[model samples]
Target: MHGYTQDKDEYAARLRRIEGQVRGLAKMIDNDQYCIDVLTQISATTKALQSVALGLMDDHLKHCVSEALTEGGDTADEKVREASEAIARLVRS
Candidate 1:
């Protein structure tokens, strides 16, 4: 019922779908699918994973970062900075 609980449920659902996509990709390889075809599926899986990451990052900024800022000063800024660096890494990859 709480906000965090709701966000956690959504994240779990997204991850579950990504897990299934990975398994499907394995099956595709086993079936001797073409290289391009396999690669396309892999790309899709990667995009799905990225989407999940983005969603979680959004939740982190809106909830965690916001709450930290309200309670602490430099410590909260440090957390936000760390989170920004993490997002930058994710975007690069």
Candidate 2:
């Protein structure tokens, strides 16, 4: 089975929850919640977003990377670099 098929719904649900968390965080700020509390929620949302990114990277490596490597040459290297740089950006964000 394709990697996305195994648990796509679960991943989507998690992302939805993360979206809700973000909205809640915004509401908290509007309501003047404690700074520390707002910061904590922001941190949690960041982690959640990271988790989604990591999962996407993992799937891309498993599928796109493998396919590109099989196709061969400089193209594979370029794709690998692209994926690497994307993950790096995700980490930095």
Leading candidate by lDDT: 2
Candidate 1: how large is its RMSD? Answer: 2.2
| Model 1 lowest lDDT segment of ten | 1-10
Compared with the true structure, what per-residue lDDT tens digits does model 1 show for residues 34-85?
9999999899999999988787777777778887889898879887897889
The global C-alpha lDDT for each of the candidates, from Candidate 1 onward, is 0.85, 0.88
> How well is each residue in 1-93 modelled by candidate 2, as lDDT tens digits?
554666689889999999899999989999999999999999999899888878978888887788889998988998799898998898677
Segments in model 2 whose C-alpha atoms lie over 4 Å from true places: 1-6
Model 2 worst lDDT run, 10 consecutive residues:
1-10
TM-score of each: 0.86, 0.85
Question: lDDT for model 1, on a 0 to 1 scale?
Answer: 0.85
Show pairs that collide, candidate 2: none
